[model samples]
Target chain A: MCKNALTEEKFRELDSYVDTLPEKHGMLISVLHRAQGIFGYLPKEVQLHVARSLNLTAAKVYGVVSFYSYFTEEPRGDHIINVCTGTACFVRGAEGILKELENHLGIKSGQTTPDGRFTIDALRCVGACGLAPVIMVDGKVYGRVKTGEVTGIVKEYAEV
Target chain B: MSAYRMHLLVCGGTGCRASESKLLAENLQALVMTAGMGREVQVVITGCFGFCEKGPIVKVLPDNVFYVEVKPSDAEEIVSEHVLKGRPVDRLLYVEPEQKGKVSSHGEMPFYKKQLRIALRNCGFINPEDIEEYISVDGYQALGKVLTEMTPEALVTLMKKSGLRGRGGGGFPTGLKWEAAARNRADVKYIICNADEGDPGAFMDRSILEGDPHSVLESMAIAGYATGARFGYIYIRAEYPLAVHRLEIAIAQAQQMGLLGERIFGTGFSFDIAIKFGAGAFVCGEETALIHSIEGERGEPTNKPPFPAESGLWGKPTCVNNVETFANVPPIILKGAEWFASIGSEKSKGTKVFALAGKINNVGLVEVPMGIRLREIIFDIGGGIRDGKKFKSVQTGGPSGGCIPASALDTPMDYENLTCIGSMMGSGGMIVLDEDDCMVNVAKFYLEFTCDESCGKCTPCRVGNKRLHEALTRITEGKGTMADLDNLKELGAIIKDTALCGLGQTSPNPVLSTMKYFWDEYLAHVVDKKCPAGVCTALLSYYILPGKCIGCTACKRVCPASCISGEVKKVHEIDQARCIKCGACLKACKFGAISKK
Candidate 1:
């Protein structure tokens, strides 16, 4: 498929970057970060390529990938919605906002919509406690969000 | 140096940036240029002003007028009136909530009155991306002093005398950590700056990294010199894009200025630093786990005795320190240990930066001296509870910490005192909870966090925490008996005793402390099968009051389960058997007929 060729080019680019590193012993995490950036998510092939490039076992690569909450093996949607559920956010009624979003999207947290338009996830804290009950669509932060505003927020992203 | 007539300092912190402070800065700049006061006036986007409650804040120098909640449109008035005509904007000033008067200067504000600024000294003042701005404030002087004037042993001794404890909740003496690393002779020693601030409600570390990154960098270089390490790594969180970008710029600027990388000031000491990104793991805040994470391993903690100082980071002696702890280093080297020691209580020296959030009136960052009373932090500095709500408890130290009840408001906040009262001065996340928040739900919330974050390396942490979370869940769901309460206590104690790492050891603190203080609430949940705070939806039942019901059919139309029955203009009744307790009807009713209990 045409998509496979495009992905191969990305793989070559990742390989070139891995080759440029002076030391490869402790560069797996950094390489995986780059791989995820390029591919959007780390699939089996990408993880295998990273494992081969870093001289790490595929199991080792998978172990590191699965250990961190930041790394994901599955493909993500175009827009990722992260609702802050930290203590500050929780106390400030973030649960109501999250529930509203879950109902609006008809998908639970960590699951993408059927159309693959948005993926909702819960963040422990983005260190933006000053703006309690915060959410980030893609990377743009929306702070002090109310349950009534959840549908309007999703509509902006959905239209885009 | 061009001496500008006046300077406008804008808050460029994450909170303010979220509120479009950057656009406000650009607007101010454009206006300044248009007024031809570009040379006469300077608009600098500095780090967090600490008063994030009323951001985006813009402060005017020379006059020292502090303005809060500034919009991009307000930039025109600020430049036209404040900057051009030398007249301060009256409406934009921070008003004292209690006094009902506008406070002109930051010094006069109650939010900053009781606060001390040591770690956050250069945060709001200096331009973090510029090396010259950092140098202007005696920035690398400590590194220079340590490198040229003092020997390695003397630097270590001076640090030991400073009595600066680790601010990352361990409260370990910084000097002793350095001494251990210095004592262990290795060819390739390392200095790691732990910027993996994982506490949910805390952002002080990110603020420091974003606002005054050079402080942490300068301290790390000094730490390297003291420990005789040539290479260092700052393991920071990847989630903080602004902090990561600022640190990259700061490192490049520092390297170009000969402050970092290779021989500094033409000394034989050669040092360089690199950044390692953490991929969202809370356990990586632990030093040993952090070391493993840097080595590209699954960030799991190994046992102590072979500590990071003894054997770490490829089995070499490594000195790992927290961002806040390292930020305190440069000042201690510049000002002697006694001067720093005199500021706080005897054991806990210097100040602690706490991220005051949740139901507090003024939710922001405040660095107060140790031994300050909790009431001072909550009432005086924080402006008391938001919406005039009754303060129930304040959760400190994040998930690893416990809630302090209102009775302990007068208790002094130090390492020992906090530990004595079933809490630790964790990474300083002070989330104030009001009477509306349920204590049982709060305990469950922390337990859920710990259970999800547990690395599964130890049995007590992985299995025991899951069980504790289930017990807490049972209590919250009104399905718990008194025996479940006993099981929670017993399992919590066992987990504390048998857990391998600090993450597991202190995980049950929230549950235990809440049980100790709010046992009556828990009893009400288990015995009466009722949630006193009305937070547990499973324990709540909705009823329509006949006195207030207008029969508008609003509740009937909005009910997802179609459980509400009655015609229009007639009193509606919710079918008790079919009611899902979604509270949709309660929210939709216009007459305020619905009540939950």
Candidate 2:
């Protein structure tokens, strides 16, 4: 398993954090956030860690994490890129930009580059409709981005 | 002694960030460092501050100086004047809409005056990545209470008294769902948090998970305790990378503290959580479909005779709740159940988190009491329509719900109230529609989304939604008869009645609601062969007004269709026959000559 993946010791570490938690319910989110910060993903051992920490059964943690669209277990790349494909962005040429990024990165949406330098993702809307064709790189947004500029923009991040 | 005792909190939500809040932070940090007062002056990048119209917001600690719309260039002046010299940044202060030049803090802002935020309590107060900050704010108190003081039965009773219901489309009593799972005699029960918020223009779940993942995790643990569940799962779409990352960190923190594993709080109970990734299938938002997807099957909803509570993951009794629903659990537990029941209307017991997006003055996440009127959310909280445009309709519940017209703005925003008015508060996505929005095209837009997101598990949802979309498309193109309208109503009702899952059942809501409220728009499309809002390409004609035409040849030069032929400073005539109604000339026109009718 990768270092980002979970381990028995990591599970213990997460479990210890849960024990220190004053409350039970709201801690799952924070615990998961911390786990990801440490392990970079919510793997099985990490999930086990979360379950033990929150005083929840593993299946319960699994069920809650699985039910939501905001929890993941897969290891992500170093840098993440999300291109908005909202109504406003769609009306603009967002699809062309996304396609160009996908081709340049040699990976589809939800996949990281083979070198683990970048992960490309498509989002619904980043609320920058006034500046359509918006792309967010690691929480920093670049608005009015063109398809032709995608490769150069991504390369800057990759080289970084 | 620490040189500077005061801290500065800046709004760093997507909205504020878009308005150069990060740049502002950088400038302030740089200025503070240069002034050699960096150690004492702490800057915290917090979540949504709610008064989005006045963002990027900056709040000074101790004095509580709330500054609104602070630009990057203004940051150095704020630091130099406020941080170093003890003078406030007067110019960037928030000016109230009603009282011009009167500045106020977030507490004094009218947008937050009438609002009560439980789900959004920790959002703007804490750094989302830090568990300690959340802990200081009493983050996991409910989980501790549940584990130490309350039994499964007692917890269920408290929930029942609270009248807490699912915030994820279905307003089913949360206590009852827990009770169902509690009553089920199973060795391995499960709790599921439904974070797969697939509704169009919806981000309530995403924001909660991002802003406060700990709350959801802690609540699910409480649910596990109440329902006698041995495990939990959070089924989130692969899209929300930030939320996912935060959740992962929270889980690790929980585990490290020994709150999750065997013998938590010296108790014998043991529970664990895992995350399952979604491929952006909208239908998976449904409980049964979600359960099926988690079980390594296709994400399609099965019949409810054996509901997930009866037979869920691995054919076990499972209690499933949405992200918003789970978020409410901790508060209900910490604060008495009756305390939760006190707020909102009688039927709905608590606040609802809505993504107040599209043509609204305040386009961000908002949490309001259930009984609050749509008028309050749209006009007051949302600061009314953008650009002084008249409000036409507001689409709630994504593509599955109906368009609520301005006449129904006073309607209470509870589950039953919204449903009674031909709209359901499905996932709390309220897309504000302006006068420029064509109702016919709006229905078509939602229909198209439904058709695409449909899981194709049932014939009614798969085929019926597509046909409805086709009819709406036909009407938009001015090629439909009144018969098409009748057919839509008939087909819509059938899909609702016969569809196996909620996706199909509510898919026809937009078409039905628009037909009821904006029937004139539909009639204009069919009878007059015109798009009243000029949204439908086939029904629209781009023409340059004779008097207003500058005849600068700008329209002709920019027209991709070559549809305009005119002389300079003379009457410009658009060749309507040749015009594709692309509106290129309309956008390029300098003298406001072009018109689409």
Q: For each predicted model, how many residue pairs clash, with residues at least 3 apart or on different chains?
A: 0, 110
> Each prediction's DockQ?
0.81, 0.09
**Candidate with the greatest DockQ versus the true structure:** 1
Candidate 1 lDDT tens digits, B360-474: 9899999999999999999999999999989999999998999999999999889999988998999999999998999999999999999889999999999998999998899
Off by over 4 Å in 2: A1-123, A126-140, A143-160, B1-4, B12-39, B51-55, B71-74, B97-99, B560-563
In the range A1-160, model 2's lDDT, one tens digit per residue, is 2656556777667667767866665355556656766777776877776676566788876765564434566678888898886644554457679988998888998888878888787776655444456889987778768876888788778678
Q: Which number leads on lDDT?
A: 1
Write model 2 residue lDDT over B71-97, tens digit each, in one string. Answer: 889887888888889888777877665
Identify the candidate with maximal TM-score.
1
Docking class of 1: high
After superposition, the stretches of candidate 1 with alpha carbons farther than 4 Å from their true spots are A1-6, B561-577
Assess the local accuracy of residue A134 in candidate 1 as a C-alpha lDDT between 0 and 100.
96
TM-score of 2: 0.82
